[model samples]
Target: MAGVRPRAVVADDSHFMRSVISDILEDGGIDVVGQAKNGRDAVETVADLSPDVVTMDVEMPEMNGIEAVDRIMSENPTPVLMLSAHTDENADVTFEALDKGAVDFFTKPGGEVSMEMSRLEDQLVEMVTSVAEVDATAATGSEKQTSAPTSSTRTYVENPTLLIGSSTGGPKMVERVLSELPLEADFRVLIVQHMPDGFTERFAKRIDSRSDYDVREASHGDRIGGGEALVAPGGKHMIVSNYRSGRLRVKLTEDPPVNSVRPAVDMTMNSAAEVITDPLFGVILTGMGEDGAAGIKAIKAVGGRTIAQDEETSAVFGMPKRAIETGYVDDVLPIDDIPNGILNTAKAEVN
Candidate 1:
């Protein structure tokens, strides 16, 4: 009992799927302490069994994953890794679960099942193992999702080009920031959120539904304009191309992954820094690893405004924390203040 392998509960509505996941986890060396078929059962099992981590299904019966996540965090606060389907609607709910304080997520290889489900075995094991190691107490009191006041007195962005980057715990953090960006703060936003292939498109659609401006996945020749945003597709890199101040566009590249990940924030942030000269804003939010640290410095070399989400507000504080350590970050604000912080930086006079 003293040296038992870390225990986990596999939660899903389907028996076959649960068996598959349980086998993977057990084989990967974690003990399958319990299993649940629905959100309510998952919540209750977590309380009763108190496993090291929970693999939650995003769509479950009785009480959907979002509501269950809220209850679990409030009552038990155990680490949770969501398993989600790649659909626009589920994308919306997945982010909601993250917002409710789940540690991270892994997308199921396909909608229902296929031979490809086997591909997720290694990734699933890795996520569960790594997340089990997270000190959830360190991430307590995550920044509350709220809007910064948007008023005429706020600094005005002058044809600004905004670059956003994140990795772990990013989907919800990205959505929260984009959802609250002021309508009057018209700018072209390029985003690089580290996710697996085929997930970013749905993420973009989810943002589009809630954002005041148009939000969609970046393509080879998409025109970026005021009140428009582009999310880098998951498997391809996004770069600024055919650049004109008011008419910037993006192109996707199949170049190999950087920092061991495709669509690295450094790739897009550096690209945007190359083209945009005036009123550029670079924001590095919550994530793991140092992927964006160098790119934020690139923004600063050109006098672009750089902001990193502060440690207390970040889910992992790896990217933003590393960016801050470089001394390139102009401001280290909480997640809620980041959108407004960009506006304030944009309004400053550039000598």
Candidate 2:
């Protein structure tokens, strides 16, 4: 913690919450350069102070966090960390902020200030430090490309469907991959990330803004289409079903949690495997648990290809490592290579 001290701006409607966050950053050796009481102020503070990072709160008076994030990123792009209420409503706004270019977020505690701040101290510090690090690297134009296997090139499937699973550091990682995808790729993508309710819609919207693809939260009975990315709704399960024409459609379910998560990766991957006979591509990205391993197995069992993020590039290696350990992953790649792999696969499939 002795390197460059990260400077941050805290924006929230709650003065108490702002002070608590400022204290936590100070304790973590980060400089809280400024504070904002609303989204408009947050925007101006960012413009004036140009801090390395901003901790934003949703549902602020005057301008909301999502709108502010949009303005900040468009004008003077600074890394933002959204402060979300633990309620389902706030989670949605938080995800929207991310889609709008904020880096990540933390759920504010529901009750006492001391208890809540204590619980979130580590996460806040970690997110702030990480965003600052990424921004610094980006500013210096020294960000490294993802490391993937060069031995065997990836091959795509005909009429391929892409399935992705992630958690924890997923938002930024997913943004990086999706933003690089071709706008006209002839495949549909499905993503299942473990999150609280109300967040997935915002996450999908965020991705859509940055990506050429049409990204949205999956609705029950929604038809899957090429050039679209469907993010499973949080707190529910998203399954795949076959239409009469043999095309795939999404089915949202309230099924019991699998692998301790309702929107489990295994649930969606298994459903896709059952419905889609063609070669599919399953990707396991940065996350903290083994939720995707079983789903990856289902994909592999159906002769579909599987790829897992390598540990060096993972925020946490649990999910991908589990898939690799199961001997299901066809490739263990770094984050940068993932989009390329998918692209190469899509190209090979077409041929």
Candidate 3:
């Protein structure tokens, strides 16, 4: 096992796609241990082979990817990477798959099958390899539900801003945190969940349906206050800047990606730290990279409070670990305790 390559099972209804994905993995140094033509086969194959990772197609005959994810997580609990198309339906199902315990998703550049598939070679392989290291069993069993805050104190911060950043295994944590917040909470939240185009809008809509705040995808020139939570749009960096009369607005830019990702959390949080005069809070959640570490430091340097999700509950500890190492984070709490921590910190700050 010392010299063995990581193993993967490629699952797709199309033979051509299966071949393409297998070749990509094998060429990228991963072994193609098994191939499945449908979701049912995918579950059985994974349960039998126990590959290091699984590349799952969103749509397949007999059983779709979402259902397969639920079944696999419930029965076998393997690390799964979803390959999704860029349509609204695929976007919706992809999130569902994620909620059911899929590790992460890679968007199909064009359609289900295209020459563009080759373009995804590097990113797809990286995702497959990265997710292979995740402890799927722990992730599947991690608590997803949050309860009411034990503390009854809520302090009103005038025009305060809260910036949240997350990546792999982030959507569920973001949703849970937002849902736990009371309806009257006044933080102007700007969320930077690492995602690609054609997905963030639907993600914001999903969160809005379940949360109390007026959550929506951020648009250029949109004001950043009045209890609104704006999710940074996919494929663009959202930066906060001072507008007329001391008001703040978000500006979307196609600036070069930082940390290999557009819509980078650093881009948004750093900007807000420079411009926002009101009380600020930075929350670093589960992710795979250090994009938010410097942003957390910048927020703390500007006298804003910072919190990070602890490793026991994080799907991936990279982002939160990096932020915690910065010596700037004021608190490191589990996912279940973060909403209350934020509120208590706000109350303590106000007092």
Q: What tens-digit string does per-residue lDDT give for candidate 1 at 1-351?
A: 455688999888988888998999999999999999989999899999988889888888898888888888888888888888877677767777877888888888777433466777876787787667655655556556666557556656578888999987778778888888877878788889988666788789888887997999888989888899999998898988767758788888999888877898888888878877667788998877789998999999998889999877676778898999999999999888887787777663545
In the range 106-184, model 2's lDDT, one tens digit per residue, is: 6676731335687768767876776664442232233355533232454334467889999766887887788877655
Lowest-sum lDDT 10-residue window in model 1 = 134-143
Q: Give each model's whole-structure lDDT.
A: 0.82, 0.79, 0.88
Q: Indicate the worst ten consecutive residues by lDDT in candidate 2.
A: 134-143
**How does candidate 3 fare on TM-score?**
0.94
Top lDDT: which candidate number?
Answer: 3
Measured with C-alpha atoms, the lDDT of residue 222 in candidate 2 is: 89
Candidate number that wins on TM-score, 2 or 3: 3
TM-score of each: 0.84, 0.66, 0.94
Question: Clashing residue pairs, candidate 3?
Answer: none
* lDDT of model number 2: 0.79
Error of 3 at 27 (Å): 2.4
Look at candidate 2 and tell me the lDDT of residue 11: 93
**Which 10-residue span in candidate 3 carries the lowest summed lDDT?**
148-157
